[model samples]
Target: MAVSTRTSSIGGHQREPSGTLRLSVPTSYGHKRVLPLLPAFRARYPRVEIDVHVSNRSVDFAAEGFDVAIRILPPSDSSLVVRKLEDAAFVVVAAPGYLRRAGTPQTIADLQQHECIQFLRPASGRPLPWYLHEDGREQEIVTAGSYCVSDDVTGCITLLRHGAGLLQTLRFMVEDELRDGTLVKVMSHCAGSARPVSLLYPHRRALPLRVRVFIDFIVEKSTAWRRAKL
Candidate 1:
């Protein structure tokens, strides 16, 4: 769809897109990537005020009065209109400093011989499962850690940086580490497939102009991440 050049007016007055936008996002993704692009959105829509809640808890759009929400987790609520965004692949990683000290695992089964930081879902009190390519088949492997973070997949990166343990997380989250040699991919051969990313908003007859532009802005800027890096 093409955007119209026609000026928008309200009540006989030309108005710039303006309104308050309340939203929620996963903590680490919001802070590292999504939140950084916001200044550009602010420049485009000067009058739009944005309020964001960075949390692991699932949001109730109507019950909480939120306008939009971005989640890495699968959608559990069917009421909101969900627009899937970029998909991401996961990688098992460790810091170079840590690897030098503890040594690398030679095989997927060898991971048990090393320390591994794990992530858990606060909602279910269960650790997120790892799917590794093994013997020409994707197999599930349960990983454990001395420390765990609920809903914050990014924290695993921080821990891995400290030589806490090997952890599997989004490839994008550790790109800088991989590029600078601060962190090394542990098992590229057994890395997993892409996982869904999505944005959710109330299902309504029409979205407010302010909210609509934001949705467009985010989705438009997200094209690069949509490409397969694995």
Candidate 2:
């Protein structure tokens, strides 16, 4: 879609008209990876205004009138167009104090002996599963801990930082702390599964100008961001 670059004046003030874009994104560690792009997006398209709705539950983009939604897991519905943005690796992390106090787990089996901070989705009462990969094989392990909280990224990180049990979180969430030694990787050899970050939009014959522009921008910037991280 071609967007008009013509500048217009509103209320006697010369300003570009802002195009509103609605997005529904999952509230998870993955959001920490994608949310940083908003400033750059706004800088590039100053006329675009974005409204982000954060939720762990799947949203009906078409039904809810959302322009697009970014999700770690793509929707199963065939009517939506899904674009894979990047592959993210998950890791098991614990605060330095927690590891010093509880001792670090040397293997996947050792994890059973440590207290694990579990994430329970508020929308659904089920606890998130920790999928670990070791020796070219994958295993889904259900972890148990004394502390259980709703799926909030900040809360989980805070709990982990306060010497809570092992947390199975996306690498993107703790990259800074991991580099600075605040949080330590528990199982280096057992790098967990990699999940794809995807962009989902309605499969319309002609996408709105604002939606098309933002989608293209995200695809371009996401590719560059992923490449730079490598």
lDDT of each: 0.80, 0.79
RMSD of each: 2.5, 4.0
Question: Which candidate comes out best when scored by lDDT?
Answer: 1
Candidate 2 C-alpha lDDT tens digits along 36-64 = 77887788778789888887768777568
Q: Estimate each model's TM-score.
A: 0.88, 0.86
Poorly placed runs, candidate 1 (over 4 Å) = 1-7, 10-12, 228-230
Name the runs in model 2 displaced over 4 angstroms: 1-18, 29-31, 228-230
In the predicted model 2, the residue pairs found to clash are none
In candidate 1, position 14 carries an lDDT of 75
Give the Cα error of residue 170 in candidate 1, in Å. Answer: 1.2
